[model samples]
Target: MALQNGFVRKEGIPPKSRSRRPAPDRRYERLLARQGLAPTAGVDEVGRGSLAGPLVAAAVILPLRIRLHPWLDDSKRLDSRRRLSVCDWLVGLPGVAYGIGFASVEEIDRWNVLGATMLAMSRAVLALAEKPGVVLVDGREAPPLEMPVRAIVGGDRRCASIAAASVLAKVTRDRWMTEVGRDHPRFGFARHKGYGTDDHWEALRRYGPTPLHRRSFLGRLSEEAIPHLPWDDGAIEPRGGP
Candidate 1:
């Protein structure tokens, strides 16, 4: 397979002979073009399924004429070092802008993961200093935004702007977990970034649940087996004294 124009083409196809395949996300491009928008923001979220840590959302606005990076793709498809490097480059770009937002564990418990994820995305879009004319979001549902919105299923894989957002969110959240790991070293947050990996599960069993763990999620587990480990209820109590 040979790469061309943000897609992989078969080896035998000559560039001149092959009919140009429509751009994977041309609908979004056409929408922006129709509106005469120079910077179209793409938004995505990470850590929605984590048993610990906050849900992180990122919104990225890329210049309309961005040249595709060879390594750019969905964040899940890239390894850690490459994702971090790309994220740094993306943040420093002249015409690009990005921001991150997070929903805390308590918010996740109250609103549930999907709702909290959307809330985080909305906050990220709002955090941008320069307002975007139109926002493109990864996945099938669009989070309500102050500006126009379009949600594309698999946008991260198909759209460069959305892919860049995914990288930013993933890298930012991973770095956050690593920093938190230093304080709570036993959880190994730096290693798994709060995902429900076997190591993370073992750590949970050993240390009970940390403040970062989603209490509502733990409540749904089999009580007979795991015992629903106790948390410091006083720490999470309402601010006013009882």
Candidate 2:
């Protein structure tokens, strides 16, 4: 079989790739489990850097020891089909508990992306029927959760629960933006998933921002040509720049 780009690219995710990161594992989970955090949940957020749409987060608690996708790592590392497949498996998988939460564009403008991300993560954790013993957050900053929080840099790639959460949050947000794309076909939200893509920028330049756009994000990322752009939403300290 002819290998494409040093690996066989297939309809679903293949075992190998041109470049590969270490797949997510249960190392952190075991470490924490030994420390008495039996039910540890992983929390991850997506769409933080988007120019439009809501910021979403997901919390997932998996069984102490179980085998999942051999290729599971970060949601960003997977194709759409594999991510959705893993998401479905995680959701339906026995002994897995998860929750999803969102912060609207208004909230992002109001609290700043960092603050809004913390808010979304907190909401995701709280959305669960029963809180876990501890939370393993994907980033260095921990969310304001009632339970213990252990923030790990690149937890999504190093932690199984966090990887699951990442996939769930990403799929949820992507589907949401795709639906919005139906109503506003010009912005190509479906294609870019609300990222600051070139097509998205051109659309914004021609049609202006929709209700879904973050005014603060636009003012920071775009040129001054757009008239009446909200430079500062007055919700938070104006953060980020060109």
Candidate 3:
């Protein structure tokens, strides 16, 4: 974007229209139905790499008959406002059951981010109104649960249920961060949503980490935190050893 007469000007090829974006298919649901799995749950987590705020997970079950909208894609593909609107719409739909869960910052520090993510995912599944026949997790590692689990690397982009879960989880965490930002306005948690941006690090330097900051991620509050797992644009690859 370029500033033109105090207004932001857009250049280069225009971004693709949302209607053109591919919608998550119902392949997973159809396959599950063939195997007698009526209600398949899709699970996804958000804020796993955040320097602050709790890790949130959501489980969503979209009925097989419901038609997924083209705009209903991966949470990462949509902006914050769009994600929030999608989540709200999904929850209100008939035959759509979803659950939201969280793991506190202290839990993240104690169990490490990956372990805490699993814990949160488990909680999300358990929170559902009724247990699903099978769970489709949006990653390589599936959380331990009583029901059958399938780990799909890009489930959110390919599975409608997973995409809905991602949007719900993302908006839930973003809203939580925004509410917490009121208590601690210096860190700008509402803006970055607890990501380790340069401005966030500067705030940590100036005011030091609040109780919400994950101690495991601090690296003694140095310029750069150790154990960098290469997180970019919310596409975090969880390490086995945490």
lDDT per residue (tens digit) for residues 1-242 in model 3: 87655757688745445665567888888889899986899999999888887899999999888777556879999987788678778878898888888888878988999999999999889989978999999999988888899999989998999999999888888888887688788888889999999999888877677777787887756645332432222322221100
Query: How do the residues 1-242 of candidate 1 rate in per-residue lDDT, one tens digit apiece?
Result: 98988778899886665634322344575568687864688899999888887888888887766665666768998898888777878887887778788888888988999899899899889878788888899988888776788898889888878888898888888888877678679889999988888878777766678777888877545655463555554233111100
Pairs with backbone N, CA or C atoms under 3 Å apart (clashes), candidate 1? none
Query: Which tens-of-lDDT digit does each residue in 1-242 have in candidate 2?
Result: 45666866665666554455668888888888899887889999999999988899999999976788765669999999999889888888787888888888888988999999999899889887667999999988998777889999989988999999999999888888887678788888889999988888888887777777888888644555554454343332111100
Error of 2 at 166 (Å): 0.5
RMSD values, in order shown: 6.6, 8.1, 10.8
Model 1, TM vs. native = 0.81
Please tell me which predicted candidate would have the highest TM-score against the true structure: 2
- In model 2, the Cα lDDT at residue 176 comes to 84
lDDT of candidate 2 at residue 94, scale 0 to 100: 80
Deviation (Å) of 157 in candidate 3: 0.5
Question: CA lDDT of 61 in candidate 3?
Answer: 91
**Model with the higher TM-score, candidate 1 or 3:** 3
